[model samples]
Target: MLSTMRSGVRRHSALLLFILGAVLLTPLSQAQQLQTKFGCNMTRDEDGEKVIYGDTGEFKLDGERIEALRWESALYRPTHGFECSIDTSDDPQAEVEQDGDKSNWRITLKDPVAARHQRGYDFYNHGMNCSIRLQRDGDKLHVIPSCPALCGSRGNFTELSVDLKTGECSYK
Candidate 1:
């Protein structure tokens, strides 16, 4: 009877330790997935004109739900230049929806004219329909933007590829 009781106690202690370890490690694992940052900068000379463009952003999550995000893009050309930016730090119109490893961000501008003017693209009419999609695959983050009104003639935000490991970005 004594040996049997000792074995039972040992088993219970082992189970308790396992449970405590899992409880302690769970949050650390979740915290690792709670934040992500990506950006890229590239410049090239085409037709004797230097073109500079890139995207940079950071997003924070709370148990798979995006809590905040700030993304910006810029393009410079000889004839035209534009810059676009979105922030959810304090804007109620900014919404982010998560589906698996993909997220869709949409924002309704309260002052479309001011937004356009701030980005230095006042020529393009502000339609107040700004949308962006993001996908994460391993160490790569793909950014796809459909906000034509935010980006003028010389700016393109589609097919932006970011290397999360290296903080580099390029347009494919």
Candidate 2:
């Protein structure tokens, strides 16, 4: 009878430990699911010109640290078609920082892109100082690119705002 009681106690203790472990881990699993994923493609008419823009990426978190991030953006217009396109998939220098509910991404190109000089007379290597900044708030992502090398004198990659849920975007 004593051996039976001891075996019952051991089984109960094991069950209790399993329940406690699951309860403690529930919040962590929920937090991990809060990671953000965003993708969008949009085009609109602005002053009789067709403007196209899009972006796709995901930001994953491990505990309080960003474990992985990949992002890409593109913009096109009739006036300056293919203004800017950036892919940070293989860029080891890409970095993201989070503050409160907002996140900021800074990306620099590893190779120079060819572009026409500001004079429009000669070709020059652009993207040497190319830098892109992306800011995310709620379901919106804002793209601010300072890549003169990617866009020559004939075109520019103006600031853009994108809606992650609806895939609607507009120049800002």
Candidate 3:
């Protein structure tokens, strides 16, 4: 009889532990509802004309997790190292300035990923000096490196646009 009680107690304890572990390890998505995935569409503007700038991606941010959605295009510049974020607060304004130029827009995200330059940078005076731009309209946040200047005046100044709500990117 004692053996039977011991076995039952052991089984109950194991079941309790298993239930606790399962509850603790369950994914947050399974426990809670997830809103629509944050995304963006990127477009670009060049040479006084609007063009479908190819090869871009969108980023989704949940709390602190950021995921990049890449598009297949041979012309997209890889954004690897840079500092950008979306700030959505009482004041909805996002801007980044480079090469003595300033871009002001009205969309705020927490922290957006950095896109690499299509063409790298010129090493001058031991300081990184590059031309980039900021294109802003309504809920769109676009980042364009002042390219024509970087391309020895042979390339077009590209523009990057992002939808603030969905984090979509489109190169113009």
Candidate 4:
């Protein structure tokens, strides 16, 4: 009876150790496997579908389209558009290419850009026309973009997710 009790305690201790080790390593493994370069906030619409605000890209204020250089006197901008429930790809290599009326935007992460945006060790040029602020929260991101004063006026300063092609804002 004494031996049996001793064996049972040993087994329980082994199980407890296993659980503790797993809990400790889980976060490390998950962090290493994270591949998403989280961009812009995606919200749920009326139907609860995930979506990023697709802005007009034209950068307007008070219903008037401002020039590229006059984008600093503005206040209130909306440029986030990614929703967890509906956002598909967390591709680390998204980029934007101007194609016809809309843009062909792909959010890609090359080593050079990854270091600056992720680690903050390097610097990437903030195009005078627009500035994208990428805020990292653990494995997630709060992507925000602003129309700088270089665009002409204090332009649209919203951090809304804009459809690169249509520049349409998500109405949700």
What would the per-residue lDDT of candidate 3 be over residues 19-131, giving only the tens digit for each residue? 99888756432322112223333445546554443434333323223232222222333432122222222122233222222224222322221112223333212222333
In terms of lDDT, model 4 sits at 0.33
Supply candidate 1's per-residue lDDT for 14: 100
Q: Candidate 4: where are CA atoms >4 Å away? A: 37-172
Off by over 4 Å in 2: 1-82, 88-92, 111-122, 125-127, 152-155
Q: Can you give the TM-score per candidate against the true fold?
A: 0.57, 0.48, 0.30, 0.24
lDDT tens digits, residues 55-119, model 4?
22222111111112111122222443211110111112333333232222222223333333332
Q: lDDT (0-100) at residue 143 of candidate 1? A: 75
Estimate the TM-score for candidate 4.
0.24
Which candidate tops lDDT?
1
lDDT of each: 0.64, 0.59, 0.37, 0.33
Best by TM-score: 1
Clashes of 1: 1
Summed over model 3, clashes come to: 36
| TM-score between model 1 and native | 0.57
